[model samples]
Target: MGRIQMLNSYIDNLTMLQSLNLIDQAVSDGKHIHHSVVNAGKIVLMQKDVQLRESVNSADIINPDGQAVIWASKLLGRPLKERVAGIDLMENLVELAHQKGYKIYCLGAKEQVVSKVIEKYKQNYSKDIIAGYRNGYFSKEEEPGIAKDIAESGAQILFVAISSPKKENFLYDNRQALKSVNFIMGVGGSFDVVSGLVKRAPEWMQNIGLEWFYRFIQEPRRMWKRYLIGNSKFIFLTFKEKFKNKP
Candidate 1:
């Protein structure tokens, strides 16, 4: 499939279903795939950070994860149908794993969150495809053993829920060692969402791209700084790029 090249990375040309199909094919063929998301704001911010830029560009599949990305696509006259959030993609992959009887491994999130997500998956899916899971709080020294464990489990699809940059770097650094897996997706905060430890914004809020606002209200102490400070910088950088016609 042809991809849409944004500033620093290429967003996958496929829709959600098409992306899922590609992942299924990769699993069937035993190919390693690293998937990430690119939003306009994120793209603009990462443009100034060489390491983050390289990591994002190296991802095998970069989906337009936020409404800002969809809006940017429309501005460029290549309108994406919808915002393909990473969490939604992670859930879809789990469903596909269940249908295909593929062993799945989840790495990231707190121990309780990961456990709860696994339990929720067992309750929800038609097939039990989860092979193993580990919390995201492990030390750097533990990664090699964890990688070995996933490989030994024969899991084909690995869902990683750690935060960005770090998760991308982990996959990049461990891709060779994780030969048993066909797909490794960086699904930020997905485990928390899936386990219902964190509530998503209402559909209306999400539709209007006010989901961040809802989150800010929900956890003012925690989210206020991220939204107030980080989001402001993101917006400023985005506009700077727009006016300068440069990333």
Candidate 2:
């Protein structure tokens, strides 16, 4: 996989299988790989959020999580191979954990949501694949302790499903405490989908880059600002970058 700069961020141009292979290699070699995925909204936010930029940019593997991001990359003359959606990556990693006899720790989502995810994972894969789990409802002071617990849980893979910036910061801040974990990733809202609390867009919508709209329609009041405003800003920024980079 190669890393390319686009839209003021770095994205690893990797297919889903490539990403899974890299993670598997890291885990097998007992090395640490901090993973992150960037979408249109996050790229726009990172323009003004220095910490978020640092946290995401510093990751060992950064994937394009939004189809809009893929389109923007092409517009800017740096086309990506595919969009590696966070939920899809998480699902593949869970299977990887099962196949490789690795354990994963799930941290994020509501209490019932995370619980249901763990239960479902146990049902789908074996319960042995779960190292530990906790709801994403801790305070700032609890962050260190939570990281410590995951580190000691014998988990080879760690997935944080909390919201952006917060999840990014938590993993960045506690990187030292979680040093033993072989792979670390931020999987926003993945638990909700896994727990059947949310529905994913159809394949055609995803292929056409309307997955965000599908989500927005599900809860317009909650997602209008995120999708509508955020996407507009992203489009503006992408064009701005394209002009700025002109030779």
Candidate 3:
């Protein structure tokens, strides 16, 4: 799949099904595919952060994780087919892992949250699909050992639930040690949702691209700066690019 430039990053023009198929193929072929995604907040940050930009764009597949990102792609004259949201894709991969009997490594989120997700998978799917799991509380110095542990776990897919730049940089930096893993992607806060600590927006709200608003409403204090400032910056950049390219 080819990538299309949108703002400061390039996004894979793949629908959810296409992304899942690619992952399935990679699992079958025993190939490693590093995947990540971009949302408005991440895009806003990437514009000013060089290392983060490099890490995100270095992915084998970087898809549109936010509705604004998909809309911006169309606005920028490179229409992405759809948004391959991180959480949904992770669930799809989990189901795939269950059917294919591929093991998975879980990293990030609070210990209880991650544990709940692991339990949910075992209860809902199968127990064998989980290779190992760890909370997202380790320091930077502890990362190398963490990578080594995951590599030795024989997991086929690794889903990291840590925040943006940290998760992005971790995967990018540990690419060599994680080469044994078949598919790697970062799924921010997905464990919380799965654990029922936070609720996702209604389907109607999600369809209308207001999931961020829903999330902001849920925890305004924690998410206010991220949604408000980040989204505003994204809007400004989108129109700036649009105006700059006017014929």
Candidate 4:
């Protein structure tokens, strides 16, 4: 019998290539794919949030979406080799979708942001594989019809850029209705980055895991709370785990 893994503790880290390969397999097999990321900090925080934990753990592909996760993997001597940022994965998937002639459905970002993202994709790809796109803001009551439209559009891949638990919950709730889709990725804020609404960190900043600082500097008012508070809590929890030897 297959062993039952600990949802709270087990780190299923994957590099960019490994993640891309899984996406390829899922697309080829016509299987619904749900994916999320978990770092050392998120793992411990998720222990208390059962629904969030279950949703992430249930993902068909779970990547180490943060640098802290890559660091932890190396410390554990089972290094993931690289970080697979969600934004990069989304771009890679778009390339694959265009090459494979797969229709894509994009859902998330503000209305204008979504429009700009679609326009950018068209400009870059020029092959017309994007079946449709919708802004992130929608009444819960309208979700059923929206899902139906996407399924009928014959879109093979669906990219959900709605932030965090919302995107995760959407996938968990609508996996059945998304039957027409073979790949569904929860890509938070990737659309904004791709559409040039937000700037990405420089190579040096990203390499040293100071990307958050770069963002904080760019939009201090909006990001101060997230980076200053959320990041500090994340660091504290990571150290807590280290002292506890949870890994």
Candidate 5:
């Protein structure tokens, strides 16, 4: 797995299947792997958020979660293999856990959303695949306890569906407390999509990299600045880096 810099963040240039295999191997070996995925918005935020940058870059595996990221990599003369979306990867990992009989701990999202995701998983797979679950609400002081609980859950894999920075920071800060968990990754809004609270973009839209537009239309007021402004900033940064690296 080659790790390259894209928009100031390191991304692993691996296909979806390759990423899954790496994670499965780590889980099988009882080794800890902190996984993360970065999209356009997250990378734009990371440019100024030093802590967020550290948390995400420190991960053992970082995949390109946005097609924009793949395009950006190409523009910078560092073409990535493919986009390994967080949601898609989570869905695959859930199936992997079921096949391998590896328990998983679900964290983040609202109580109803997380519970619904767990229910869906149990319905689609088996109840034995679930080790434990918790909503994404907690005080700063409560983080250690939550990490301790997940660590002791006998879960070989952990999926956290919280928002950025928080999820990244939480996993990085409490990594020691979560050492018992073999594979940990932040899934962003995957719980919402899995629980049927949010609809995912169609395959065509996702392929063309307009998934962000699909999300923006759903909650324009909430996502306008994130998609519109953040995307513009990302474009500028990508171009600047491209020119700076030109021979």
Candidate 6:
């Protein structure tokens, strides 16, 4: 496995297809895998969030979810093959689960969104492939129980779509309780994308790393600071690392 360090986190140097293949191998061999993803916002946050940094770096897979991350890796002397975006990974994994008869449990999004995703799977894939599902809202006290429920659901794959740090820490804290789950990943906002509540950026924009701008256009008030400030911070951090590495 190839990896490159960027600021406070390390990202797997994996293409989307390679990631899917690794996931398939993990499921087939019955190995437990805890997957994590990082973009600019996440990496910036990780610099000050010790637990976030640990949880992310400790995962079996840490994919670069933002195209900017791929560019940073390249500029800093560790060029990743490509961006393994989270939404894309989730979609591919869902299809993989369908074709392979692997059970999946989706945890996140509102009830309606998650329901739609589950229903989509039911319509397109084997009906029995959905082990169970629950929305992302829950009291902090309820986390352990939810983890237990997902563990007992007999799901081969678990996709969690809650917000950052929370989703990552939840999986990290309860990984012991989720031993029955073969592959677990925190897919932020992927449920909304899959359920058609939000449209992904067009391919050309995504290729040029303007996906954030597109998302900002969709929900400007909500996403502006995240993308604008977060992207700038990421660039600074990358250059900081780049200069630090110069001999």
lDDT to native, each model: 0.79, 0.95, 0.94, 0.77, 0.94, 0.91
lDDT of 5 by residue, 159-225 (tens): 9998988999999999999989999999999999999999999999999999999999999999999
In model 5, what is the error at residue 167, expressed in angstroms?
Answer: 0.4
Candidate 4, position 166, lDDT:
76
Q: For each predicted model, how many residue pairs clash, with residues at least 3 apart or on different chains?
A: 0, 0, 0, 0, 0, 0
- Per-candidate TM equals 0.90, 0.98, 0.98, 0.89, 0.98, 0.97
Q: Model 3, 10: alpha-carbon shift in Å?
A: 0.8
Q: Write the per-residue lDDT of candidate 3 for residues 217-239, one digit (tens) a residue.
A: 99999999999999999999999
Question: Relative to the unseen true structure, what is the C-alpha lDDT of residue 19 in candidate 5, on a scale of 0 to 100?
Answer: 96
Model 6 lDDT on a 0 to 1 scale:
0.91
Q: Tell me the lDDT of model 6 at 3.
A: 79
Q: In candidate 5, which residue ranges exceed 4 Å CA deviation?
A: 245-247
Stretch of 10 with least lDDT, candidate 3: 1-10
Off by over 4 Å in 3: none
Candidate 4 per-residue C-alpha lDDT over 149-246 given as tens digits, one digit per residue, 9 for 90 to 100? 88888888888989767777787777789877888878888889888999999989888888878989999998797677766776665556556765
Q: Where does candidate 1 clash, by residue pair?
A: none
Q: Write the per-residue lDDT of candidate 6 for residues 1-247, one digit (tens) a residue.
A: 8877878788888888889999999999999999999999999999999999998999999999988988888887789899888888988998899889899999999999999999988998877899999999998899999999998988999999999989999899998999889999999998898889999899999999999999999999999899999899999988998898568
Worst 10 residues of 6 by lDDT: 238-247
Candidate 4 wrong stretches, greater than 4 Å: 1-10, 39-45, 76-78, 245-247
